[model samples]
Each structure stands twice: as structure tokens, then as C-alpha cells.
Target: MQIVIAEDSVLLRAGLTGLLADAGHDVVAAVGDADALIEVVERHRPDLCVTDVRMPPTHTDDGLRAARQIRERWPEVGILVLSQYVEERYATELLATDTTGLGYLLKDRIADVADFVAAVDRVGSGGTALDPEVVSQLLARSRRRDPLERLSPREREVLGLMAEGRTNTAIARQLVVSDGAVEKHISNIFTKLDLPPTDGDHRRVLAVLRWLEGLEP
Candidate 1:
């Protein structure tokens, strides 16, 4: 796949370029700031654009703002946005649209290189990727409805891991359970929480994000 990148950190930008190039994806252009990012993206029209949520001159939501613009002007262009933390406001904004080809994740998730690339691929193919922590915080803050209150202790544990964005295999590893059992727990959590029956990972994440959105102010 062809790609464009927008990130302010020099080390991370270089590392990401190397990672993507190693995966046989072409890096059409990479820029240091949001404005430069926009210019390169429009020039190259790559398969996907991965950007950081914060960039100069304000060090605020420049990347997200750029992403929203891309969604507006080039709706078909895939976008993956990374942030340093699980921000409810940011998550809420990103989830407000039901558009495909979008992802919002914590920057540290890049350490899991395979998952990171998978996210890029997912978004490029029109999907969503969100940090698990974002889901957890959202779930945590939902004090009123308490849809999750009925879960058993084990189910609650499984729900927490899912919110952390763990795959069944990874969650099984963490919980010391078989993959099959992890799958069962996830299903139970979904039933208990009334989550959508989307089998896709990112879509399931969006379902989780929707539930969490209710808790945000």
C-alpha cells in the first residue's frame, strides 16, 4: 500500500517509515507538521495517511483537525490518528462519525508493530482502530446506566482486557486461558453489555466506544 505520514517527533517518524517500508508499503511522503502533512498528502494521494493528534504551532489537535478535513475533502482517503493518551474528548469526537477508513490509537501501541500495521491496513481498507484504554476509561466513567454491572468477576476481567484492545490470543495469554475460553468470555461480555454483533475487531471497538461515549461530559 502507498502511504503518507504526519508526525512531529523525528525519532518516531523515522521509525514508522522504516516499519512501513519493511512491510513493503511505499512511503510516498512524510512531514513534520500538520500543514506540511496536508500538502504532502494532497500531492501524493496515498492509500493511507497516519498522523499524530498533536502538532505545531499549537501542539493541540492539529493532526485531528487535519484528519477531519481529509475526511471532509477526501472522504475515501484512509486515516489513522495516534495520541499519547486516552482522551475522552478526542475519542468522542473521533467516534462521532460513522465513517469507515478511520482509526484513533495511543502512540505507545506502535510498540506492538504487527498490531500497528494491522491497524493501518484495517483503516486503509475502511475500518476503525481505537486504544483499549480509551474504551476502559469510557466504561469506567459510565456510572449511571451500569450496563456492565451484571457481569461476573471473570467476565468483568475479560471486558477490561477487551477495552484495553487485546486480541483474543493476547487476552488469553494475559489471563492464562485458552483462546476458545477468551472468545467465550468476550461473547458473554458483549451479550451482557448489549454490544453490537459486529465480528470485525475495529467495529467491535466502535461498539465499545459508543457505550463509553455516554459517560463523557
Candidate 2:
């Protein structure tokens, strides 16, 4: 896979470049700021872009803004954002549109090299890879008056795992339930959330996005 990296920290940028290269992937460009990231991405058109959520100038959401723009212009390229903290607002915004080829992971996840690489591969292949922390924060902040309150505790658990980009089989395994049980729970969740039935992988993403959007101010 061809990848472009955008990070203001010199040490972390070099570290990520070396890590991905060691994993048998090509690092096409490593840039410091969002502007350079946009330029490099447009020039190389890499398969994936790994970027920090904060960069240069004001040092607040620059990388995330660039990521949204890239997704708008070059919808084909995958994006995985690394953040030091869980920014639910930004995550919600990034996922508001098409959820394909999207990921938002914590920088601490880099310590788990294998998992990080797997997340990159997953997002690059047009899948979601949201950090567990992101899901937890979003769930914790959900308003009591929202439709999410209609779900049972078990259904909420299933929805959380789904938001973390887990497949039905994976969710079943994690919850120690049968695949049919997981499917039923998901069906209940969708009905309770009032999400229209969709026949695609995006239904899970859309359901999660609907829940997240409700938490926004």
C-alpha cells in the first residue's frame, strides 16, 4: 500500500514512517503540516494517509480540516487520524459523510504495532477503524432524552462494538453470544434508533453516526 503521513512532531513522523516501511508498505511522503499534506497527497495520490489531528499554524484541528477536504476531493484515498485525546466533535464531523475508508485512532495505539498495522490495512481496504476510547466517550456523553436511551444495556454493548468497527462475527465473539443473537440485537438497535434498513456494510457506520450526531450541541 502507498501511504502519506502528516505530523508536526519530527520524532513521531519518522517513527511512523519507519514502522509502516518495516511492515512492507510504501511511505510515499512524510510532511509536517496540513498544507504540505494536501499538496503531497494531491501530488502522489497515495492509497492511505495517516495524519495527526493537530498541526502547524494555530495547532488546533488543522490536520482534521485537511483530512475532511481530502476526503471531499479525493474520495478514493483512505484516511486514519491519530490523536492524543478523544475529540468526539471532530470524529463525529469526519464520519458525518461517507464512512468508507475512514479511521480515528489514538496515538497510544501505536505501541501495539500489529493492531495499528491491522487498522491501517482495514481502513485502506475501505473499512472503519474507530478507537475504542472514541466510542466510550461518545457513549458516555449521549443525552438521556435521545433515542439511544431506548436501547437495552445489551443492545448498547452491541452498538458500541459496532461503532468500534467490529463485524457481526467479531461482536458475537466479544459478547460471547451466538451470531443470530448479535444480529437480533443489531436489528433491535436499528429499529429503536429509527435508522432505515440499508443493505451494506455502511449500515453499521450510519447507525453509529446517527447516534453520535444526536450527542452534538
Candidate 3:
């Protein structure tokens, strides 16, 4: 996959470039600021962009703003944002629209190269790849009355895993249950959340996103 990277930290930028290159992906451009990121992306039109949440100048949300702009202007390009902290507000904004080809992962997750690479692949293929910590933070900070109150404990577990972009088979393995059981829990979760039936993984993710968005401040 062809990728463009945007990070103000020189060392981290070099690390990310090396990681992607070692994984056999092309690093079309690795830039330091959001403006350069936008320029390079427009010029290269790479398959994916990995960007930090903060960048040069203001050092606050520049990368995220750039990601949002990229989503608006070049909706076909995939975006995966990395952050040192879980900023629920930024995460919400990034996911407010269609979440296809979108991801938000914690920078620490890069330590697990295989998992990070899988996340990149997932986002490039138009799938969600939210950090589990981000999911937890969103759930914990939610101020809205629990729409999720109706779900059983197991069903809520299923929903959390769903929000983390786990497949039914993967969730089953994690929970030590059968795929049929996982599906049943998911079905119950949809009913409890009042989400209409959807056939694809993308729609399932959308349903979870809608549920989470309802809990936002």
C-alpha cells in the first residue's frame, strides 16, 4: 500500500517510515506539518495516510484538522490518526460522518507491529480500527443516559468488541464462545440499542458508531 505520514517529531516520523517500509509498504511522503501533509497527499493521492493528532505551529489538533479536511476533499483516501492521549472530542469529530476507511489508534499501539500493520490494512480496506483504550474512554466519559442500560453484561461486551472493529469469529475466540453465540449476542445488542438490522461489517460498525455518538457531550 502507498502511504503518506505526517508527524512533527522527527524521531517518531523516522520510526514510522521505517516501520511501514519494513512491512513492504511504500512511504510516498513523510512530512512534518499538516500543511505539508495536505500538499503531499493531494500530489500523491496515496492509498492511506498515517498522521499524528498534533503537529507544528499551534501544536494542537492540526493533524486531526488535516485528516478531517482530507476526508471531506478526498473521501476515497483512508486515514488513521495516532494520538498520545485519548481525546474523545477529536475522536467524535473524526467519526461523525461515514466511518468507512477511518481509524483512530493510540501511538503506544505501534509497539505491536503486527497489530498495527493489521490496523493499517483494515483502514485501507475501508474498515474501522479504533483503539480499545479509546473505546473504553468514550464509554467511561459518556454523559448521556445509558441507552446501553438495556443490554445484558455479555451483550455489552459484544458491543464493545464490535466497536473495537473485531469480527464475530475474533470476538468468539476472545470470549471463548461459539460463533453462533457471538452472533446471538450481537443480534440482542442491536435489538436493545434499537438499531435496525444491517448485513455488512461496515453497517454494523456504523450502528455502533451511532450508538456511541448518542452518548457524546
Candidate 4:
């Protein structure tokens, strides 16, 4: 896939570009700031934009803000944001709207070349790729006596993995359960959460959003 990278650090940006290129992806442009990111994206219109959360002109959330703009203007292009830590607020805001072709991962995850490349591939293909830490933080901070109380412990586990954008087969492998058993648990989760069935993957995304919503006050 053709890609663009937005990162302030020269080394990290170059590293990301080289890594993706080595993985058989085309790196069309790599820039240092949010403004440049937007310009290049507009010009090149790459398949994906992998960016850092904080970038130049403010050194705050410029990259993230620019990412939002990219989504608004060219929703077809995929967005994969990399952050230094698990910022739940940023995670929530980023995931609040349409999740297709969206991803939020920690910068540390880049160390795992295989997993990072896989995440890029997923998001580039119009799939979600939220970090496990993001899901875990939300799960930990969830208030008591919420709708999620309806879920069993195992069901909750399934839900969390779902939020991390894991497929049924991956979830089964992680939990050491049969794919059939994973399907059963997922069905039970949807029923318990009051989510009507639609397309299977769409329902999974909804179930995850529902779980995230329940974490709210």
C-alpha cells in the first residue's frame, strides 16, 4: 500500500518509513509537522497516514488534530495514530465516530515489527486496530453497576478483545478456546448487551462501541 508518515522526530519518522517500505509498502511522503502532513496527504493522497500524537507548530495534539481533519476531508484515507502513553481521552475522542480504517497504537508497539506491520495492514484495509492497552485502561476504569454488569467475566474478556480489534480466531488463540466456543461467547455477549445482529463484523464494532459507551458516566 502507498503511505505517508507524520512525525516530528527525524529518526522515528525515518525508521517508520524504512520499516513500512521493507514490509513491501510504498512510502510516498514523510514529513515533520502537522501542516506538512496535511499538505503531503492532500498532494499524494496515500493509502494510509501513520502519525505521532504530538507534532510541530504547537507540540501538543497537532498531529491528532490534523488526523481528525484528514478524516473529515478525505475519509477514504486510513489513519493510524501513535501515542507515547495510553491517553484514554484521546482514545475515546478518536474512536467516538466512524471506526473504519482507524487505528490508535502506542509508540512502543513499533518495537514489535511484525505486530506493528500487521496493524498497519489492518487499518490500511479499512479495519480497526486499537491498542490492547487502550482497551485495558478503559476496562479498568469502568464504573460499577453499569450495563456491563450483565456480562460474565469470560464474556467481558471476549468483549475487551473485541474492542482491541481481534478477530474471532485471534481471540480464541489468546484465550486458548475453540473458535466455536469463542463464537458462542460472542453471541452471548451481544445478546446480553442488547445489540441486534447485523453483519458479523459490524456487530462486533457496535458491541465494542457499546462497551466503550458503558464506560462513560
Candidate 5:
């Protein structure tokens, strides 16, 4: 596989080049800044681009932003971002747009050279290779913003029962609550979930569907 590396650190950049070269992959170009990285990518159009999140000219997220632009313009070129830390905002944005031919691994997590090389190979071949920490962070962020998190414990139980095809009377019986109380809880659930009142049955079904969606892996 042909690869391009963009890292601000000279030693790390050379290390990456040597590793990829030793792994039987061609290092078409190794640049030290985001702008140079972009230029080299356009020139070589390598199969994969290995880049650091922070790079020259502000050193904030120039490399990550450039990676996004590269993915937008040349989607066929896979991107593998190596970061000192997880910049969740840009990382999530990149993955949210498209995950194919993409990878995000922390620098500290690359303890094994073979694993790092395998990740590069996998991502270069249009496969995903997210670091475990990255995956965990993404999942945590998703859960934090989950709509179901707004529901109270009782409301969540009511929703689960509703998803199980339980009527208000049955739900009340299961929860040891009066039918009127169950009705109020159901109304609150609908309101909190923002389920419109198009039709009573349709709204109930929609609420149940929302609950079911939250249960997805």
C-alpha cells in the first residue's frame, strides 16, 4: 500500500515512515505540516494518509481539519489520524460524516508496532480501525446526549412496558400504580419524547419505537 504521513514532529514522522517502509508499504511522501500534507496528498494521491491531529500553522487541529477536507475531496484516500489525545469534537464530526476508510488511534495506544501496521493496512483497504478508547469515548458521548436520558426512572419503566405491548391498565398493574397514574406517566413520556399527537395509537407506537431505538447496540 502507498502511504503519506503528516506529522509536526520530525522524529515521529520519520519513525512512521520507517515503520511503514519496513512493513512492505511505500511511503510516498512525508510532510511536517497540514498545508504540505494536503499538497503532497494531491500530488501523490496515496492509498492512505497517516496524520497527526495537531500540526504546523497554529498547531490546534490543522491536521484533523485537513484530513476532513481530504476525505471530502478524495474519499478514496483513506485517513488514519494519530493523536496525542482524543479531540472528541473533530473526531466525532469526521466519523459522523463517514466511517469507511477511516481510523483514529491515540499515539500512546500504539504500543505494538505490528498492531499499528495492521491498523494502517486495514484502514487503507477501506476498513475501520478505531482505538478502543476512541470507541468508548464515542459511546459515552452518545449516551450523554441520548434522548432517553431525559426520562425519569419511572418514565423509563413505563416506556419499557409500553414497548412490550402493554396497555395502560396492564402497565399500571405491573407497576402497582393506578390506571390514572399510568395515564399521567404516559402523557409525560409523550411530552418529554416530543411525540406529536397526530393519532393516539400512532403516537403510542412512535413512543415505543423511540424507546426501542434507545435499546439498540
Candidate 6:
């Protein structure tokens, strides 16, 4: 697979470039900043993009912003983000789309080269991957909805996907349920959250986003 890398750290950038090239994958561009990253990506449109969460010129989430831009213009290109911290906000934003070709992993995991490469391959092949640490922290810090505490395990599964911007049809596909069943669960979710019934999709999404934001550290 052809890949483009965006990492401000010279050592890590060199290592990643060497490893991918040695594995017989084309390393089309290895850039050091998010602007350069975007320029190369827009120019080459490689098979996948691997970037650090923090990158140069301000060094504060430039890569994440670039990733969001890519989701807008080249939604099909796979994205894998490496981060030093387990920011649920970052993971949440990264996986906002229903598409599976997105991944977020902690940077320390790069030491396990084989596993890191496998994750890259997974994202490239259209699969979602999140660091186990990210999953645990996200679930732990979210609002303690005691009413959600009353949900059946299946209902809780549905709620998580809803928080991830999934449609009822997509949720049904994920849970292998009928659309009717998914709608029933969504109604239950609204009632439990005390959200008034709404006709627009944006209202429900806003409610969920606010709920998620309130749980942030």
C-alpha cells in the first residue's frame, strides 16, 4: 500500500518511513508538519495517511484538524492518528463518520512495530481500530447516566454507536437488528436522557454531543 506520514519528530518519522519501505509498501511522502502533510495528501492522494495528533506550527492538534479536513474532501482515504495521550475527544472526533477506515492509537504502541503495522493495514483495508486504553478511558469518564445504568447490555451497545454519529440504519447493521428495533431503542434512549422528541436529526445529535462533552475531564 502507498502511505504518507506526517510526524514532527524526526526519529519517529525516519523509523516509520524505513519500516514501511522495508515492508515493500511505497512511502510516497514523509512530511514534518500538518500544512506540508495536507499539501502532499492533496497532491498525491496516497492509500492512507498516518499522522501525529500534535504537529508543528503551534503544535496543538494541527494533525487532527487536517484529518477532519481530509474527511471532508477525501473521505475515502484511510486515516490513522498516533497520539501521546488518550484524549477521548480526539478519538471521538476521529471516528465521527460512519466509515470504518479510521484509527486512533497511542504513540507508545509504535514500539510494537508488528502490531502498529497491522493497525495501519487494517485502516487501509477499511477497518476501525482504537487503542484499548482509549476505549477504557472513554467509557470510564463518560457521564454516569444511572438511567443508562438501567439499560440492557444491548441497549447500551446501541447508545455507544449513537454517540459515535451512527444512523439508526447503521446501528441496525452493526447490531444485526431490524430497523424497527433500532428505532425503538432510540426512542427509549431519548426518554431516558429526558430529551424531548424532535423531528430533526441535528437535535438528537446535539443532545448526544452535549451529553458527551459534559463528561470531559
Error of 3 at 130 (Å): 0.4
- After TM-score superposition, what is the CA distance of residue 176 in candidate 3 from its true location, in Å? 56
Give the per-residue lDDT of model 1 (tens digit) for 1-217: 9999999999999999999999889999888899998888888888899999899868999988888888777888898988899777767787788658888889889999999989988998888887788778867766545665767899877766777788889989999999999888777777776765655555457546744663478
Error of 2 at 84 (Å): 0.2
Prediction 1 TM-score vs. true: 0.64
Global lDDT scores for all candidate models: 0.83, 0.92, 0.90, 0.92, 0.92, 0.84
Report the C-alpha lDDT of model 6 over 1-217, residue by residue, as the tens digit: 9899999999999999999888778999999999998899999998899999899888988999998898789888899999999877777777767657899999998888889889989998889878999888877756554455556677777878888889989999999999999988877777766677566665567557655764577
Query: Candidate 5: misplaced stretches above 4 Å?
Result: 146-217
Candidate 5 C-alpha error for residue 79, in Å: 0.3
Ten-residue region with minimum lDDT total, candidate 4: 138-147
The model with the greater lDDT, 4 or 6, is 4
TM-scores of the candidates in the order shown: 0.64, 0.67, 0.67, 0.66, 0.70, 0.68
lDDT of 3 by residue, 20-95 (tens): 9999999999999999999999999999999999998689999999999999999999999999989999998898
lDDT accuracy of residue 19 in candidate 6: 90
User: What alpha-carbon RMSD in Å does predicted model 1 have with respect to the real structure?
Assistant: 15.9
Q: Please list all clashing residue pairs in model 2, or write none if there are none.
A: none
Q: In candidate 5, which residue pairs get closer than 3 Å at backbone N, Cα or C atoms, i.e. clash? A: none
Model 3 Cα RMSD, 1 decimal = 14.9
Listed per candidate, the RMSD to the true structure in angstroms reads 15.9, 14.6, 14.9, 14.8, 10.4, 12.0
> Who wins the TM-score comparison?
5
Report the alpha-carbon TM-score of model 4 versus the true structure.
0.66
Residue 95 accuracy (lDDT) in model 6: 71
